[model samples]
Target: MLGAELREARRRAGMKVGALLEVLGFSARWLSKLESGHRQTDARNVARLLGAYHVDSETFKRVMDLCRDVDGGYLIQGHGVGGADEVSAVRRHEAAARQLFSYEAVGVPALVQSEDYMRELFGRSVHLSADEVERCVAARKARQKVLNVGVPVKRTFVVRELTLRHLSGDREVAWGQLMHLFWLGNTRKVDVRVVGQDASFGYWDLYSFTLMRSPQFRPVVHIGATPYSLLFDEPRDTGFYEESARLLLANAMGVEESRAFIAHLAEHVGESVSA
Candidate 1:
């Protein structure tokens, strides 16, 4: 990100890379590698580039802040995009992002999942012990408190109609989870949308994804919900997922309709909430 900014700063100044490299006393290959993100860079190099670009103090400070902010929070978005940035732990995201847009191709988004759903879902995982399941459920509930009123982080969740009917073996568990979604969907902090089965969205083929936007750092996209998920931070890639989220919102049912959809499905799928 530092390198991309530097390269852009130079171009915005109408300075050629060859000329800037000469001023910096560097080789073309070296500068090229840095701008392309193939090589790592440090504060000293960033300072020199910003100075040469003669960027305004605010731009300079913002870019520098991005470098510092990203130092410890992220991992390289590798070829396969695994490792959790925020999707893995729902709480970390409220601090990291100003807004979150999530799409799940199948089951409920993790943030809104009910305790019973989590227990049943986690119990299916052989890798997690019984103790691990309890710990995770407790932590998830605590983290989800941030989803309530007055939190600054904006949240949007788009899911398939299939998720409404999606059943766990336990009717009680499924009922609890869908009711939780109904309640959560009505929250001021959350905007929920459901894509009807009849709707055709090309990206529907995708398993699941989350896009995060923050004033402090670049946008990020976490693809898939499983342990093996991909995180994309590069502007080009994150931009694509961001656009995908927009399209999803355009096609999915409106917020009120979505709440009704989930409510109707929940009413039909299992015993009533009163039961």
Candidate 2:
């Protein structure tokens, strides 16, 4: 937890290791060791770090607590959270995060599916073997564990009409995914919206993005990709994405509208008939 929060805070503040050490009057090696989890955090160092980051008292206290928890191995720090490791980490973070937001500017279905669904779509040309597809599905399934965990995360989702229209699957698979979204939107697990095709300029023009917030860190956006995803820790960068996300929500269809849209699409695959 300490390592994650520190990395995010530093990135958000746009402070590199050397620069951060200069501001805190600490050695570069010390900060490096701390972040690497090779050295236990001390109060004096924690105070220096909090002051260097200009965090207020309340935020600083939370940061300190996270650090302590990380050092004691109580927080179950997750490593390599992108690509193949994303499945478990996504679940853990979603379950642990206080707030979870997603911007489905594009490729939204990729983030919400089982391996079999993907293989049925991309396997013929992409050549993903059964084992690889299973691995990917396992990871995706792990992420859904967040829905049943204690103190479930508050989830908000903004999707574009293009995402639904450009879905990569057969009629049934596409319909199933849309139905899943429809169900989630109606349930308490998420707040869902769809950006209309005719809407004016908005935040979701950047393809796709996701945001995760916790008590220890302000917020971080993860940019998704076909090959992998990257984390945006800089506050300035994240702030821009946040503004775009807000605009997306503003220009999107309300929950009821999105639900209706999903139902209409699901009917094509005969999913609504059973629903």
Candidate 3:
């Protein structure tokens, strides 16, 4: 996490790694190792780099905090989250994640949600002001950049059948969402599944969670929380979400079956939409 942050900060500052090596009197391999997470970095090194980068206070604090994390904690606890602020943190991980797994029991995952469906979903939330809702939707759209075909991120999305069946209790909206999900399932590097009666998911109540893994940073588990969500980078916390993700996969319909099922559901419900 520290290494990744350093690289991001350097790029933001438009500083070439070669230039930094000469100024910092560090070898190329050593700087590469530090920025690649191959070797843990110290505060002194980080301070010097940030000083050269001329980073702002927030980036300075964030980077220095990551430096102090001898235990290598990258947890972002957003107790007082603004609409876009917390999502930006998660989006940073999503932007760099090599792989992503999202399980949504209540509604569609943000990464794959259609624009209309997302706006409608957010419209129902009383807690979010209009501007806040707009910012949240915009942030999700930004994060969805990872879904671009050229991006290397592989994504898996598992959603509940019931949630698809009656989303916002609007057949047209639900049909569009189902069609979108089915289309994404057939796309490259994307897998969409539906949790149906194929297995015992009756007791499942978890709303939404996503796990992101990157070779350059520790894995993170994001759980839904008030105002926003909390990110856990510890092995113990990530391990539990990993297990839950496995269970979700075990309970969800096969990719082909889910695709076919969603297609059928969309055709059945899209009559009015098409009409």
Candidate-wise lDDT, in order: 0.70, 0.63, 0.77
Q: Candidate 3 has which clashing residue pairs, if any?
A: none
Estimate, for each residue in 1-275, the C-alpha lDDT of model 1 and write its tens digit. 45556666787888887788889997888887776555667788888888888999987996777566444334332221111323332334344567998887778777777889977876787777788777767766665666763648788988788767765647788888788888876655788888988987695447577888766456766664345444546776677787888888888999888898888888876655456
Error of 1 at 260 (Å): 1.1
The TM-score obtained by model 1 is 0.66
- lDDT for predicted candidate 1 compared with the true structure: 0.70
Better of 1 and 2 by TM-score: 1
Ranking by TM-score, best first?
3, 1, 2
Q: Give me the runs in candidate 1 sitting further than 4 Å from their true place.
A: 1-40, 43-91, 224-229, 270-275
Instruction: Sort every candidate by lDDT, greatest first.
Output: 3, 1, 2
lDDT of 3 by residue, 1-275 (tens): 56777888899899987888889898888877777656776789889999999999998998787677435554444433244234545667777888899887777888889878988877778887898778767766766777884768778999888887877747777887888888888766789988885468643436578899988667777776665556667676687778888888888888899889899989888887777
TM-scores for every candidate against the unseen true structure: 0.66, 0.64, 0.80
Candidate topping lDDT: 3
Candidate 2 ranges with C-alpha deviation above 4 Å: 5-92, 109-111, 114-116, 121-127, 202-204, 226-228, 271-275
Q: List residue ranges in candidate 3 displaced over 4 A.
A: 11-45, 56-58, 61-74, 77-86, 202-207, 272-275
